[model samples]
Target: MPQLAEKVPPSVAGAVLRAVFALPDPVRRLIAGRAVVRDGQRLALDAQLLLLMTRLEGASLTGATVPEARQGLARGQRYINRLPERPVRTRDLAAADGIPARLYEPKGLAEGSPLLVFFHGGGWVIGDIESHDSVCRYLAVNAEVRVLSVDYRLAPEHRFPAAADDALAAYAWAVENAAALGASPEAVAVGGDSAGGNLAAVVGAFADRRPDFALLFYPATDMSVRRRSRELFADGFYLTDADMVWFSDHYCPDVERRTDPKASPLLADDLSGFPATYLVTAGFDPLRDEGEAFGERLREAGVRVAVRRQEDLIHGFANMWGLGGRFQEALAEAAGALRTGLL
Candidate 1:
């Protein structure tokens, strides 16, 4: 990858996608029609927009140049940037270990609002704080809590424990620095989508004060084994089994290491004291089975758990609230649960 490859601003990718978005609906449906979720459930109108993003993000790049993947990811970042903006005061900061993070404060939050430290999903490879900005803003306003979006290191460049380490460090930073940030240690929560969700689950097992609750949206819990969802939703969906393999390969690389408790929280022998969790799963996501499996494990361990399965939604729907049917419903369910638990 050339140094100039990094210089290709995300805005260019955004513009290209904006043009694609501006095209007639018939054209979009044609180019992206193949992005069908194999489960027989049609992608709703709003959910269909996510396929356009999937197309823009460029699939089939496992063995390709890093620049190609970067370019593809940039388009998704732009797609996130294009989501509706809501009222939230934001600031850029760093975690305790100096990992970059963005803080979003919803306007008119009650004094001493609860705080949520969030991690974005991209299989620990592509997504950044920018990619999940809209979801964070929506959470902040709707849940009435401030959110710290951690921009942890990615794979191929930084692998395995780097992301896990940063996630723990970010959560620690929030709890330790809660007072100054207008949140309390008791009210602090950690959550994420996909890879971020996996990190949240891992961090909950070791957090100092322990997170009060967890919000995991279709997290990849047991990468060591192939499950039913993977076989069932392997192709056509926004997130495919091949994509999961690509992600796990880049992030963990070492097959044996994928079973590490930190990498695969579901493999943990003891989860007795883990925080209450709201585990979300999209019916069409390849990782759905594992996410649910983790939830069942939590229940077996006596940890309170709420599982919401969005049957008609696909992977990445949590990040696509603009497609406001089941996607928004899922988001609302999680936010409402968090408000009840944290506030």
Candidate 2:
């Protein structure tokens, strides 16, 4: 590990710390107070937990059914609707196998504009193009690039390989129809957060030709539930252990499929021939160690890799960019990485 810095800039570090601490005590208490119980024994996720989760994530759940999960995801979409509008031209493009995407093209683009196909994060269960609109908007406006935000199918309703297939299809479409979108086929990149990031990595690994760069934000690289970090930072860190368990159960009900490389990229035996990678990790996130470890593996495989650890930040900080003060700093860092990698 690199030598630790004594202190980081307060504007970034302090703000993140305050945000994590400012979460409702009841929610924190629930996470901290949780205990492992036998499987199939019902645990009440009552109104209090639901309300707390709703407040924190802008998701709502009346019950644990798939329909309720979709409703909760819609609530998150509504919450992200507050960002200021920028000039972006929207289009419905046909991707691989007729999988469609809502592409956002920033105004005032020259020919051969760089393109970024973004996948939204929601543990592959919740979230869509609408849920991640703000993030795509920010990237398109600030980075001055065209962004193709995909609405890939979610899990439990559409499981493992389905999402990966959609991601690959999207990439193929971007490559074939780059000119129609006013982008350079060669300059196109792939990126996302959480489950989306996992998809991005998987697609990069499997694409017949790789993207120019890969951007991963707090990606869940490993699906194994046994990591030490999973146990250590599993609570009071925004993305709780219970929440991950719920997401995993919904994503992969069949335990045997957890080892599938498409489901868990960290378990893949080979890491060669993928695009150069920029991986960002939140220090307090349960997925942090695995993301960092994946970056290391990429470097070991002779792929160019840059890893940034936002030590004071928690999981899902990217989605909180519009609301959190420290988000600009993080975004700036990400933009810098993209510029270096893409240019």
- Would you estimate the TM-scores of all the predictions? 0.86, 0.80
Candidate 1 global TM-score? 0.86
**Candidate 2 collision pairs:** none
lDDT of 2 by residue, 1-343 (tens): 2111113332443344345435776764565356322222222222123224434433332226766666555554454343545687788766778776878777776778888989888888888887788788778777777889888888887887788889988888888888888898889999999889999998877888789999999888878756666776776555777777877888887888888888888778888887898999876678888889889889988899899987656677777666444555686688678767888
Per-candidate clashes come to: 0, 0
Question: When superposed on Cα atoms, how far off is each prediction in RMSD?
Answer: 3.9, 10.4
TM-score, cand. 2 = 0.80
RMSD of model 1 against the true structure = 3.9
What are the runs in model 2 whose C-alpha is more than 4 Å off? 1-63, 80-86
CA lDDT of every candidate: 0.80, 0.74
lDDT of 1 at 220: 86
What overall lDDT, based on C-alpha atoms, would model 2 receive against the true structure?
0.74
